[model samples]
Target chain A: MIEVRHLVKKYGNHTAVSDLSFDIDGGQVYGFLGPNGAGKSTTMNIITGCLAATSGEVRIGGYDIFEQPEKAKKLVGYLPEHPPLYLDMTAEEYLKFVAEAKGVKRSDMKRQIEYVIEVTRLQEMYKRQTKFLSKGYRQRVGVAQALLGEPELIILDEPTVGLDPRQIIEIRDLIKQLGKTHTVVLSSHILSEIRSVCTSAIIIAKGKMIANDTLENLENIYSGDSYVTLRVKASEIEIRRALAPMDAVMGVECTQLQDGVTEAKIDIDSDFRDKVPEQLFYAFASIDRPILHLAEEHATLEDVFLELTSQADISEESADDTEAKDGETV
Target chain B: MTAIFKRELSSYFKGFTGYVYIAFVLFFIGTYSATLNVRGTYPSFEYAIGNMSFIYIIVIPILTMRVFADEKRQKTDQLLYALPVSMGQVVVGKMLAVAVVMVVPAIVSCIYPPILGKFGSVNYASAYGSIIAFFFMGVALASIGVFLSTLTDSQAMSAGMCFLVLLVNYFQTTLVGFLPTSALASFLAITVVILILAVIVWYMTKNLLAAAIFAVVIGGANFIYYSVRPVKYGGLFPDIIGKLSMFSRFDTFIESAFDLTAILYYLTVTALFMFFTVQSLEKRRWS
Candidate 1:
């Protein structure tokens, strides 16, 4: 439903979004996962035709956003990071304006507005001025505005930033419901929100795409490297000595927790991660050290997000190194 | 476009801007019409409109300051940009809305000439002609104000800048008379104006090389023209400034010449500034 190719957006000397490319299919809730200043908003802006890419092509529903903006924009609804609400206007009036601006038929405008208001649960606040609405209600108004015209795709940028936990969940559930019928793309810095609500995730950092996959695939791919934390009734040296001879143990660090208890963090090789727990069990048994705690720590999406974004920085640094080397050669 | 026009128009009436602007303009119209036409027994209604032309310097700013600036400040410009409408449509719709708000007072003032005719002989042609000219000039000034509003996000800044621009245009003719009218003075003045234009270009495009090249080329060309024909530069600055003054063009109608060129000039300016406003909005997407 959406294709962003070689998109680059630069503000003077600083590139906000760099040569990023992605394709999103219809009817899936896609999460744009990135840290702050990671160009997620810039990419979203470009996709929704709210911004111009320095040099790139964006297409929505087979229509070029720049060349056929009206047609392309008709197929997409966008709620920017800041909910674009006129404080003086009532929610109903704002939605009416959006509906008209979207070219909703006069006959269907009322029904469409009411449907979105109902879905976003903004029926009661419909008569209130947007300024009087709280941040969460204002956000719902923004969402309702996007939901007008029944666009095929909805793009939201950090939709739940300031909302309380319950409001966030409501918005997420609303987005999930939207995903059943429409293509949804939401950008967020909060990992848990994306993991809970999004089916597919695209991770970007430093204006580059670091990872893109289904949530399950990303978890499975990142779950290969696991850590095992152990609390044993032995001295630090004995705990270390027990695991030192094991080749499957990539690295281990032990700390003395008390007179006879020691806490150890063991990094197991991917090939032996499943069996390493059993291996540690026998190793500690042979050493006459009683095992108090032994649990495998699986890598969650949060860990994957951190690893990928940080890896982006390391790769960027290496790229800088190569450029410096070339400069030195010249 | 109609949706935006209606929304903007209703907002003007709902808020203080529309009522205040209409009252302000009509108050002056009433005061001027009473003094110039009714009290002074002047037969011509154009004189009142001509006298009241200065109100635009204050009223246009108030009417147009929040049109685009408030949208940007509130971040509602994103909705406008993301909407299915083109920036041109949005801009024209807004300009039309302000024009409609301005027309309310113009329509009220339209009742003045025939009423003034009750007391004495009134040249209805010149009277209505100047009213038309006043409306055109006000719309033209409103367009310029809208363009200025797009240059900033703060309503205060937009209003201040708009007032400054209209004030300069309001007194442009008088300011030109202060110039020495010498070829050297004209050359220096034109260069300064070109430099300012170039700076604006740089500020918008953020391209230093382009601004420098533009400044040098325009400056060099102006110097070449001056050096080639020094006599042509004599009083040239003042003439250009006088022609550019929006208020000065209204005087021709008041003087009883229904100048088609002045009406065309107002329309051309209106179109030009509305086009610039659209470009300014589009440019933000790139920036």
Candidate 2:
């Protein structure tokens, strides 16, 4: 479990993470979704005790990260954005060093290292120098490092950035496996990855939390009035007249596709979206026009991400405009 | 801490830096041993160690340049900060690792004393005393190098800055003699030194107001002291510089007495620089 309250990180005059707050429960894969420069990495760094927040309180496993860093850090395994590998050291040696640093008992160190190597599937390349390993292998080694000591919380920052598609899937499966036992938090700009892997998602933009909920709930909540696109073998005016009396159809825009074919994009009211498809077919049949195509377009997680981030951008611009006006008045 | 210490020690031996440091120091020791003890027919091993003290200016930078700078450049410091260890432990662990590497050559040089004993009466008291002092002095300089390494992510910059710092410390005794020992001269020199300290503070913290306040307070205090008792200001600058020179303290061990104060001074310098190194690392998180 982790609790971050009003966390803020600033570099001189520029704020990286500003007044951010979030709570993560144990044993679930939580996706940290944000665009570039959205303070995801900064928040991860502060939670892992790798950075000092300007003013905030971060508690991991009931331990304050700043006050009881050693005790708190013992419950965390962090893999930074770059993997943080010692190029000269072998994977086994690096893992052993990490195991010792994480306070793994001498008796269990070998078994624990092997367990992580097995989990990350880095058994064969464990003896190879990390510099000789490819980026995907290096990322696996980084994950193996974080999996050591069996920390209750595993925090990774963009664990599959440069990996190929297969490697990304392997890492996703590994993270899903990790989620079964530990609380896994990973940040990525790719929305589909989050939708596929994470059970819960937190969306942030401009260093602020915009949305936090289960994946299904987020998609449903952001999925407003649905719409249907219909291709009718009728003229634009005739298609419009045919649907003009229908109360279920909220609005319709008819575009002439060819000489005799017309494409009508129908916006259905939320209450009638389901029955409108059947009603649409009968309405065209009665009008003596053939229905060429009928398809429903529902909102996806990608749309949710774009909408939230763009909404944040619009609000930020308005805020800047107000501040500029205030400055002129002063 | 042990994990870091072991890795640091292993890296030194695994790479060329540790071997280069050992060979460089031993080269000086071997040269001085042949010329001073064997060829010159000298009875003191302390003289050989004393003559070879200047080797630290070169050897320490090589040993310590990569300790923190490479970690930073390669972004491995994130691992260090995220680990279940304190910054103090990391710094002290690294300092001890460098100290172990430096002690290897000194320990090997110990064989020379007993070798000289077979032919002539080597004063084992001063010989071994200076050897111990020499080891402590190397650790003291290595601590400065560690602190210098933490200031930058470039290994070349760290090494160059450390070399320049030690060079200044090496010639500080002679440099002090060039200053005028008058009250006005000492007052002006002390003001200049305070201003330099302020500038260094500004460079590190980037707080111009704090640095300005520091300079004004220290400079004002020095001027008041000079006006109140001009005689007290005479020779003050040179005396302070001479006392601060780490190499000058070793002379007492070589020439006359095994000064416990000099040993204490070396230890204090080591502690002071080690503390600075820890603070520097901790500062990175805040900045």
Candidate 3:
């Protein structure tokens, strides 16, 4: 439904989005996953013909955004980071103007507007001016505006950023329902939000795509590395010495408390990750220390998100963004 | 285009802006018409419209201050950009809406002349002619106001800038008389304006080389023309200002002659500024 190729957006000397490319297929919920300042919004703006790329192309359906903007824009619906509501107008008035602007046929305009208002559950608030509505309802109005034309693609930027948890869930459910008929793409820094509706994600960091794959594929790629924790009745040095001879053990770290109860975490390489736990049992037994506790922890999607976004190679911006996100989540 | 035009027109009336603007213009025209035609017993209503021409200083700005500035501040401009409509259509649609708002007062001004016909003989041709010129003059200034509105997101700033622009035109002929009529003085004064133009170009494009080149080419051309025809340089600057003054053209209409060239000039100014407004709207896509 959308193709962005070699897109770059520069604000003076600063590059906001650099050589970013991605393909969005039809009929799936794709999460545009990124931390703040990850260029997700910039890319979306360019694709929707709201902003121009410095030196690349964005095509919607088959029309080039720069060359044939009217045609290209007709294929996509967009709700920018802010709701873009006219606070002076009631929600009903605002939607009617949007419907007219989108060139909805006179015959279908009523049915289409009704369908969106019902789906967004904006019936009660429609009569109220947007300025009187809460932030959550304002966002609903923004979404209803995007849904007016029944465009092929619906692109929303940080749609649930400030909503309450219940409201977030409602919007997510609405998005999932829309996914059944239309190609839906929404951006959010919250991992759980993305996990709620998306089967796949396109993760970007520092104006670059780091990972683009389904949830299962992304988590599976990093699943090979596992953490084995051991709480043993041994000195820290002895615990390390007992595991030092094993080739499958990538590294060992241990801390001793009180007289000599040691807590150790060992990193296991991919090849022997499954069997290394059993092998760890006998390795500590050889040292005459009965194993108190031994458990292997596989990498979850959260771990993969952190590790991928914080990869050392991505550069300066991601470091600050991932650090801020980490401070929030942890 | 029709969708945008209708929305823009209705939006003006939804608030106090439309009613206030219409009432405001009518308030002035009614006072002027009563004093000139009804109380003073003057057969000509052109003098009334001519006397109140100063109304545009406020009227144009009010009609245009929110044209694009409010959209930018509210971020509703994002909807405009993402919509499936060309920028030209958006600009033209908005201009048409503002023009329609101006039409209400012009149409009202037409009634004063015919109403005064009951009291005495009235020259219907000159009276109606002045109304036409008055309306076109407003439209020309409104186009400038629309372009200024596009430059900023602050409505106050946009309105102030537009006020200053029309204010300059309000006293255009007087300001021209203040200029020294010497050949060298005209040359220096014109070059100074060109230098300011160069500065504006540098600010817009951030290209010093391009601005410098433009300054050199245009300034050098003007200097060469002055050197070849030194006699023509005397009072040339004032003549240029007078000819370009939108308000000055209204003077010829008050003299009771329908100057077709003045109408054509108003149309050209309107067209030029409308084009500039479209270009200004298109400029955001690049930045």
Steric clash pairs (candidate 1): none
lDDT of 3 by residue, B4-44 (tens): 89889988998878788889999999998889888898888
Candidate 3 chain A worst ten-residue window by lDDT = A310-319
Q: Which stretch of 10 consecutive residues in model 1 chain A shows the poorest summed lDDT?
A: A269-278
Per-residue alpha-carbon lDDT of candidate 3 for residues A134-181, written as tens digits (9 for 90 to 100)? 999999999999999889899999999889999998999999999898
RMSD of each: 4.3, 3.2, 6.4
Better of 1 and 2 by DockQ: 2
For residue B6, give model 1's deviation from the true position in Å.
1.2
Candidate 3 Cα errors over 4 Å, as ranges: A226-297, A312-330, B194-217
Model 1: native contacts recovered, as a fraction: 0.93
Best by DockQ: 2
- Model 3 clash tally, residue pairs: 0
**Interface RMSD list for the candidates:** 0.6, 0.6, 0.9
In the range B1-287, model 1's lDDT, one tens digit per residue, is 99898889889988899999989999998999889877898978889889988999988898899999999999999999999999999988998889888888889988887888888988989888888898999999989989999999998999999899999998888898887888788888899999999999898888999999999999899989988999999888888888999888888998988999999999999999999999899898988
Which has the greatest lDDT? 2
